[model samples]
Structure formats: structure tokens, C-alpha cells
Target: MPRSMTLLVLLAGAFLIAGAAALWLERGNAMLLDLSSSVSSFMCL
Candidate 1:
């Protein structure tokens, strides 16, 4: 394979992995935030 093609493929793979990781982290953070908010509301009452 040509050098440019190889580099493109590697970059594409990195981008895919990064995107997946970002999505996973974002979901976890959202869940944590929701849980914290609920707990705070319960404590206030």
C-alpha cells in the first residue's frame, strides 16, 4: 500500500476509536449528573 493511503487508514481508525470513547464517557457523565441531581433534590425535602 502507498504511504498516504496507509496514513489515511490509521487516522480514520484513530478517529473512530476516539469518537466511541467520547460517546461512552459522555453517557457515563450524564448518568452521574442525573443521579447526583436526584440525590440533592431528595435531601432538600
Candidate 2:
């Protein structure tokens, strides 16, 4: 595979892992309040 394609695959895998970790840490709140709070913070800017 090309270097760019390999890099893209690695980045995607890392993103998935990080997302899973955030959800695991947030527990049930991951789907709702977590996203809402982050959006709200962005809106405040």
C-alpha cells in the first residue's frame, strides 16, 4: 500500500479507539450530556 493510504488507515483506527475510550469514560452520559456540553461550549465562543 502507498504511504498516504497507510497513514490514513492508521489515523482512522486511532480515532475509533479514542472515541471508544471517551464513551467508556463517560459511561451513560457519553451519548447525551457529553456532546451537548461540548457543543454549548463552542457556541459560547
Alpha-carbon RMSD to native, per candidate: 4.0, 8.1
Instruction: Tell me the deviation in Å of residue 37 in model 1.
Output: 12
Instruction: Estimate TM-scores for all models.
Output: 0.60, 0.59
lDDT of 2 by residue, 1-45 (tens): 999999999999999999998888779676678789989999999
Q: How many backbone overlaps does candidate 1 show? A: 0
In model 2, the Cα lDDT at residue 9 comes to 100
Worst 10 residues of 2 by lDDT: 25-34
Segments in model 1 whose C-alpha atoms lie over 4 Å from true places: 30-45
For residue 38, model 2's alpha carbon misses the true position, in angstroms, by 31
lDDT of every model, 2 decimals: 0.97, 0.90
lDDT of 1 by residue, 1-45 (tens): 999999999999999999999999898998989999999999999
Please state the error at residue 5 of candidate 2 in Å: 0.4
Q: What would the TM-score be for candidate 2 when compared with the true structure? A: 0.59
